[model samples]
Target: MTNEQANCDTMVADPVVGDGCRRYVLPRQRPGDSTGDAPRVAELKCKVAELESQLRDLRRTNDTLKMHVAKALGLQLDSPIPGAGFETTRGGKAANAVAVSRRTAPGAVRGVETQVPKPTETPTGVEFRVLGPVEAAVAGRRIDLGAPKQRAVLALLVSQVGQPVSVDVLLEELWDGSPPPSAITSLHAYVANLRRALEPNRAPRKPASVLRTRGRAYLLDSRMVQVDVHRFGDRAMAGWQALDRGDPQRALREFDAGLALWRGQAYAEVADTTHVAPEVVRLEELRLWAIEGRCATLIAMGAHEIAVSELAAFTQAHPLREYGCELFSLALYRAGRQADALAMLRAHQKRMAEELGIDPSPALQHLEREILHQAPSLG
Candidate 1:
């Protein structure tokens, strides 16, 4: 057979030709090809064109269905669908309600509607307390978080309320960078359990409002929950501003409210954990600063006796804190204990030199000289 005839034979049997028309027309048949084959080739080409048209129609129908599904799910076309293995809500409450209706009454014709009851919206009155041990409460009732590791997860989220925490970061924080093989799976389980605890009445597939998924990370919505640590910071900042503006009474009130939030040691249950240790230190320091501000306000208001009592306890608890020592000594001098005030400064100086291998701060030394000279500012 001629090379051109051989090529025609191969192209005629090609899969693309059999399934549908080739994207482009096949090479023209050889000049000597029979007239009978010409009619057969034309018929086959027409059939291929019909098949291609049908394929295009099917693809258009599929695209329309995808658009409808995206609209029903309240999802943007580009956003990825969450894993179905976890709790997956269609969109929000309204979308979920519609989806539930469709599933419960799939056979009902369009005109004849079925009455599917809507799922109850989970209440948002949740409160997280991490000023001491971590605790969660919903609608005034406390939730019994299962274990230490679970509570650690809660503490980490509460510490960074409204911020998305990646699973890798959570694993490191939970295990201090030495997680076991099952840690990732276990962390997922912890998150699921927390969702159940937070919203016991939510439907099985509904997205959680309080603890939510944001891409690969999880965020605890601050709007859905109140955290005591946040409240403490707000009050403390207000108090500091009040003090700066010379409103001692207002400053004392704000500081008292801020200090009252601490039930015990900050993040007491998880203070040593790598994730919570730094925050615990920060809060404890803020508490001490609030105490000092309150004492200073009291002294400014001529309430030296109260300042002396509070400063005495505070100084004993935090001996190396130079500012506390300074406040305590000044309170003593104001209350007519010049000798005792001078002696307290000497004791702090000696302790600093022995423990820290340094002399007292210049402010403390200057205070000592003022006391020795019986300076008028001692009043």
Candidate 2:
């Protein structure tokens, strides 16, 4: 067929410019066109469908293998894994022409949007864990959290987690009350660097859905990211509730899971910084509480031997905390070491009186009385 008849079939559609020739696009069938084209188009469509199925399968297999590798190596990376960047480039015009050729024939071109619509982004599972050193992982790959100051900023944001932190507070904590005039500008740069690392695949100029701008404040979107500190809190709270509801087995599992997630001290890298100090202190306390709760749960399950072993060390390490001492003594008593238990409580009382010139809480005192009287409920 001639170039003029090109518009008649599903073929080339090139509009010639600066010429007097006018192209009329007839959704017209080519003179020799018949029923054969339908079968050809259907076959091509089936091939595309088959290719899509294969692509999905390959992706799943890739994910499973990466997961296994990540687990086997015990990787605790603090940086984004390289070589996983998505191909955001769209199909070329020729590829679009191919698609049009295979289906309905090309029609007279009116106008098309010049900008190619980018592919929808895949949701990345980015996990930031500050339970130990501040680190992050995306899709089983480590993400470098940048320099110390940047990591500190991340810790501050993670401390507030789902809440917005104003620019002033971040600045105050960053420079420790003596910020340079360029502190705000520097802070923005740090955030930009962090966003790049955290979202390596995020489109340019797109608003960050994870680390977001909220007026004058910036908030980490809690829904889009996972924070190990938050996860631990959730598990610990669930464990406590389970214990209260008389489900020691489930409680033990939850407590153990939360405890296992701790890599080291909370905010270890930035522990000295003002922004992280309070959070470090608070998480450390919560960890201790979780330990005591687990120990208490064990005792309730009549595992006095285990409770004695754990609480003895816990109490010895934190002697000033009467509750640990109380639990230790109780566990000793239940383990049939009545004299040892009484001596332990008496020693604590004597030490408090002599060292601090203060008395133990009433709970400890009451425990002593109950032990001395051999209260039936103590069983």
How much does each candidate deviate from the true structure in C-alpha RMSD? 33.1, 31.2
Error of 1 at 231 (Å): 1.1
Model 1: per-residue Cα lDDT over 204-260, one tens digit each: 899999999998899898667877876776676677556544455777798799889
Q: After aligning candidate 1 to the native by TM-score, how far in Å is the CA of 155 from where it should be? A: 1.0
Worst 10 residues of 1 by lDDT: 97-106
What local lDDT score does residue 163 receive in model 2, on the 0 to 100 scale? 81
- Candidate 2 structure quality by residue, lDDT tens digits, 1-379: 6543443333322211111121212233457756466754564455456545644544454345435433432223332221111111112232221100000000101111111121223266878888888888888698888888898888888777678888998998889888999999999998999889888889999888878889998888776787787667667767766654456677778889999999998877668766567667767766886887687667666677998999888988898866577778878887899889899999999999999999875446646776786654456
Q: What C-alpha lDDT values do all the predictions have?
A: 0.66, 0.64
lDDT of candidate 2?
A: 0.64
Candidate 2: which stretches are off by over 4 Å? 1-123
Rate residue 238 of model 1 by lDDT. 71
